[model samples]
Target: MALIRFVLQSVVEILVLPVTILSYIGIWDPLYKRFFPYLMVKITSAINDKLGKIKKELFDKLPDFASSSGLSILEVGCGSGANFQYYPWGCKVICTDPNPNFERFLKKSIAQNEHVKIARFIVASGEDLSQVASGSVDAVVCTLVLCTVQDIDMVVKEALRVLRPGGAFFFIEHVVADKTTWLHFFQHVIQPAWRYFGDGCCVTRDTWKNLEKANFSELNLKHIIAPFKWSLISCHIIGYGIK
Candidate 1:
């Protein structure tokens, strides 16, 4: 079973490795940018179908201040704007990502989800969001992002910095499996290749532990298995933290 899993993973990664290399080198940006987002949309759509209930539970907690015109949300690593459909109606969202390639796909998502207003789409990573002012947004969101960020602590800090007092930071991430599990062993074995070919995603990150120490005024976190049969990335953590 382990050998079979390794073989399948290698095949998939081999298909994506060239695109990853070319994308970083700035060759065929248009082609790769389009292809990558298309792949992500399909993957996220499947995941969303399973996590609909969990997402509804978390997003419903986004505070609605009577003084403000509408909720302002900043989504870090907002790839293809997958969470746009989950935002409250009429709320304004500021999307930021290091990969500028996602901008076109984001516009398409915004058009489809017309009720959610897109304030702007900036090409910035989660670690350095200096472009956004401190205490500017009512909420900060990151879905499937922490696994790939260069510095998880810095990203969490930046999310807190951008959020207004009492604002929330929402997240959904697949994390390291339980230490005693066979899945944990698999995750460690394949982590290096996964990071190289899967856009810096680390399969065995202790994301929940990091979030616990992130200094959130309040945190409501839960671990769940996503609806992917025997999938390597099925173990997940979904929750929100109040700043």
Candidate 2:
């Protein structure tokens, strides 16, 4: 079975290489943008269903912002606004992503969640959020983002930079499996092809280490293996860090 899987993966990689090269060269951006949100919706819906309780608990840790205008949250890599359902009631969301293709999907999502407010959608990368001002938002949220960024540290720093004092950075990310495990071995072996096909996602990233080094005033994080049968990316870290 393993041999057959390897052969299939190799064949798919061969077929995908040309498009991957185009994607890297920026020539495929428009098509990729159009397709990625549709793909993510199908993928994340299953994930969100499985992780709903866990996500609710994580989002529960976010402190209530007692202002008449309501809480302000800046979500990095807010693809399709998948996490909008779990947000605090009446909170205002500022969405950011490198892909402009997701804005329509995000707006559609916001329309469904009537309690949530849309601040704006910024076409920006998490690693360089210069468009967002420093110490402006009450909190920053990231879901399944750290692994795909070009520089995880820079993204973490940028999140920190935009957060108000005592604000939180909430994250739920899949990280590298334990070094001695078969899953760990599989992650590294399949990473090159996976990164290209999966929109720069690296399964073997030490995302926890990056969060720890970000110097959040308070950090609470833990790992879990989601109930995914025969999945490469199951091990995940979910928690929040306070600035």
Candidate 3:
């Protein structure tokens, strides 16, 4: 039984290797955007609703220096501009995504919101946000994005650079399971295949460790497991830090 299982797993991994490689190179991004953008938007909106209260709570914790009015805010990987509705009023919002195809969705979404009418769109990656001034932004927000970036460290560095002194970096991301040995086993076993079809998202990344290494002076951590599931796959950590 063990031998058969091992053989099947190896075959699945091998079959998925090419797709994984292509995803890393961004081949599937356009295809997915073109064919499945509506589905993607629905899923993202649902998840955002599920996490809305938590987002509001985190926002309330921001330092006084972080302004909801006339303050500059940059959101990396701002897919379809799903976050615009959640942004506080009177803020200057800049939404960026490496995929230019997301612009249409962003425009449509922003059109419905008077508060976000002034929101600017940038075609850039998290690793290279040169258009944004260093130390000018009061807050940097990223949600469900770290797992998909190719260079996580570079993105973190960029976040730190753009944020003003005492600024906050807020993120809510699904991370690898910290408990459940069996789930960890499954994550390892299926990661290669998952990467192939899921836009290079890793189910198990030490995201908090990355934040710590980024050297934020004050770190606030919150771990929330999905309701009714102890499985690591559904667990998420939401927190922020000050520079």
Candidate 4:
């Protein structure tokens, strides 16, 4: 019975492999973006609510040293600008993404937030944010973006270069799981196909390790599972750090 089940699964994966590859190459990303932005807002709003609760639970005792007044912030890979709503009032956020399609959405989203009127939207790649002056930003935010960038090291270096000394780098991302043997095996097997379908999102990169190797300080790590799953294979991770 197990052999038959395994064979069926393999066959299904093989059949979907080509579609996945093409999707990762961004063949369907436009279609996805059209419908995805609305759905993403709803879904991420819920996720952010939960994250708020979890953050309070985890860091309530820690000193809230981050500035509460207007501060210059940059968000790398701010897809559709969904996170703009989560920023504190009086923050001057600059949202940047390589995708030109995101510009319209980012502008609209920022317009809705009175406190975020100082926000700016830029169409730029993470690798070349050097166009923004160094040591000018008070904080840098990246969410679910590092996995898709062509060069993670360069992105981190650029983030470090732009951040002021003692400023924080905030991030929330899903990363490769490191738990059970079966989970690891499945991740290894599906990674190629997953990346092809998910726009270069690698499910096996240990982002925390990568950030540490980049020498970012005050690392804080946490893991959270997505609200839904199929056969324990679909889980998520969240990591944050400071510089």
Per-residue alpha-carbon lDDT of candidate 2 for residues 51-140, written as tens digits (9 for 90 to 100): 899989888766553234558999999999889999888788889999888888888898899888888999999999999999899889
Model 2, backbone clash pairs (residues 3+ apart or across chains), number: 0
lDDT value, residue 219 of candidate 2 = 91
List the candidates' TM-scores in order: 0.85, 0.90, 0.85, 0.75
Candidate 2 structure lDDT: 0.86
Question: What TM-score number comes out for model 3?
Answer: 0.85
Taking the tens digit of each residue's C-alpha lDDT, what string does model 3 give over 101-166? 778888887787667544578989899999999998888999888988888889989999999888
Question: Each candidate's lDDT (Cα)?
Answer: 0.84, 0.86, 0.77, 0.67
Q: Give the worst 10-residue stretch by lDDT in candidate 2.
A: 61-70
Distance from true location, Cα of 15 in model 2, Å: 6.3
Candidate ordering by lDDT (highest first): 2, 1, 3, 4
Cα deviation at 32, candidate 4, in Å, is 6.1
Residue 144 accuracy (lDDT) in model 3: 83
Looking at model 4, the pairs that clash are 24-196
TM-score of predicted model 2?
0.90
lDDT of 4 by residue, 14-71 (tens): 8777776767687766665566556555655666665665444433322232454547
Locate the minimum summed-lDDT window of 10 residues in model 1. 61-70
Candidate 4 lDDT score relative to the true structure:
0.67
